[model samples]
Target: MKPPQLTPAALAQIRTLGSVLRVSLEPGGGCGTAYAFALAAQPGDLTHDLGSVTLALSPEVARVLTGARLDYGARLKPPRFRVLAHPNTPHRCACNRSFGVPFPGRVTPECRAYQPMLWNLPECP
Candidate 1:
């Protein structure tokens, strides 16, 4: 599968964060599942070279992230990263933190708190 594409704005933010961008899967209790993104100091076997930056992903993470796109929206208050065309995630909880991959699960209180912050997020096509 093709590696995720990062926008120039996202690249700039990632560059400031660290040399390597790591993508991993977070397994929740029961059938819940989520994706996590972080900055690493170095690259590993799962890393993808993106010219200016390296995006690291485990084999499992890469499979689920196929066709995903990352971008940054500076205009949004507080400024944040956005995901576009996330084919693997069919339903994201109102929180925007956890997603219903293949199926939806119970919503946690923490997720509910983030519901108000979910506006303007681009939906999966």
Candidate 2:
């Protein structure tokens, strides 16, 4: 299968910064988490190397990003990489910094198996 592709604009942005794109997950809001990308100089365990900029992502994030096109757009003050033609069709927040989880099932084994101590901890701001 062909690897996921990043647009020329996106490539240029990454190259301008001279760093690999590190793809990972971050808290969106409430209990949801969203895909995140940052600039890094080194590749992580799960990495997809492009000619100029490498993509370092977790296996799960990579799975969700399969066949997606990465592009740069002007939604916010600074243009940012946006995933286009994603299979899951996730919902995005007003600010575009966060997105809804695409998983259909409401719960996961990780949540189901959360330790009691975690539940007793104080809420985070």
Candidate 3:
């Protein structure tokens, strides 16, 4: 499936971070019933080079993520990534998993499992 388009802001942010962002949507479960989304930061070869950044979504989530916009804000205590649904697509994850919610808040095990891997980067902090 074709990856969803990124918002201008998201594209700019990715560029500013000197990283490439990719979306992965793989089929899941029986009849592709289950789905999940994960954000990953690639391993950097050099200390200064920016690594790859990716968002992996289960096949079922591809539709929900389509046209969704990602935003960054420092207003929060620790800052965070926010997902804004497109007007034409307002669907949430059917698995009841929350992707970009604040840390320490309720999150699915699947999402939480990838947090360490996602945020494990020198540039993340």
Candidate 4:
């Protein structure tokens, strides 16, 4: 399969992650050798210190993730990332365990509590 295209925004975020985290596509064990995108975080790394998001796709699903865009937003109710699939492509859970549902475009502020704070950076001292 061809390499997946990364959006400018996604590329910027991925680059900001530095070498602390890696995003790659690997072979899946189930459903006809699917493509899986993993967000592997290194121990004590701040790249994913906040939280990590993974996206695994079956061969059937890769088509859906290709050229897709992921954006982060803030909301008052509940917090979550917004995954926008290309037109005509159905969205699925990153785990491949279930179908994805439409979530709010803005993530709730409450979710920020779960993320590690930049203030905790050891270099702050």
Candidate 5:
């Protein structure tokens, strides 16, 4: 699978780091799942070499992050890193931390929270 594309700003965010970016995901608040970032590497992690920095995506995390991009916004208050919108996650929640439908084993409440209309109608919520 293609790795998450890192924008210029995202690359800069870890320019000074000696460790790789450890990518993971966890259940979000009634809204699918969310990306979790760290600075480390682990065994069996799916790694993507991005020249300046490496992204070590956990087995589960890699699954949900398909077609995503990493970016950094310096102008926002407190200045932070964020994921750019992508076709695979059109139902991204308002919090900007969650997206898509919740993982299986989880139910529709998570999916419905971001896209209530999807469940009620023929379109995706």
Candidate 6:
């Protein structure tokens, strides 16, 4: 898979600052998945070198983030990292904090088993 696409500004920010960036799959509302960006890297994470900066992602998130784009929003009040939807994934949840993984798409086991009846979501086939 192609490495994640980072805007030039984001690329420079991390490389110049020598920052460690981590992306992970967090448990979301209704047992969905949410993307999280942080400065801490956890054990068992897979790392990718982006020039002087390192990008770490958990195994579950790595599967979903391939081919996704990461851009820095410097204009936002506090500035933030943004990610576009991966090609194979569809719409996000109604709350906008979680995402739906279509059939055949990979998801963490927690998502498949988390209070399934409450969300009216079917278990993976």
Q: Which stretches of candidate 6 lie over 4 Å from their true place?
A: 16-18, 29-31, 94-97, 102-125
Task: Please give the lDDT score for candidate 5.
Answer: 0.68
Clashing pairs in 2: none
Better of 1 and 2 by lDDT: 1
Name the top TM-score candidate.
Answer: 5
TM-score of 4: 0.30
Q: Against the hidden true structure, what lDDT does model 1 obtain?
A: 0.63
lDDT of 4 at 98: 24
Per-residue CA lDDT of model 5 for 11-44, tens digit only, reads 8887756648887766665476667778898787
| Highest-lDDT candidate | 5
Please report how far candidate 2 places residue 83 from its true position, in Å.
1.3
Candidate 5, residue 12: Cα displacement in angstroms equals 0.8
lDDT of 6: 0.63
Q: Per-residue alpha-carbon lDDT of model 1 for 1-125, expressed as tens digits?
A: 68889988889988887767787656452335566677772333377788889888865567667798988778877687667667766556655556644322332434322232222222222
Q: Count steric clashes of candidate 3.
A: 0
Off-target runs (Cα >4 Å) in candidate 3 are 22-60, 86-125
Taken over the whole model, the C-alpha lDDT of each candidate is: 0.63, 0.57, 0.38, 0.33, 0.68, 0.63
How well is each residue in 4-60 modelled by candidate 6, as lDDT tens digits?
Answer: 778777777666555777887655554366678888688977888876788888766
Work out the TM-score per prediction.
0.65, 0.63, 0.36, 0.30, 0.74, 0.67
The better-scoring model by TM-score among 1 and 6 is 6
Candidate 5 Cα misplacement greater than 4 A, ranges: 104-125
lDDT of 2 by residue, 1-125 (tens): 23468888878888887758776655553334456777862333377678767877654466556687887775655667777656543554444444454333331223322222111212222
Off by over 4 Å in 1: 28-31, 41-45, 73-80, 102-125
RMSD of every candidate to native, in Å, equals: 8.8, 8.4, 12.2, 16.2, 6.2, 7.2
Judging by lDDT, tell me the better candidate of 3 and 6.
6
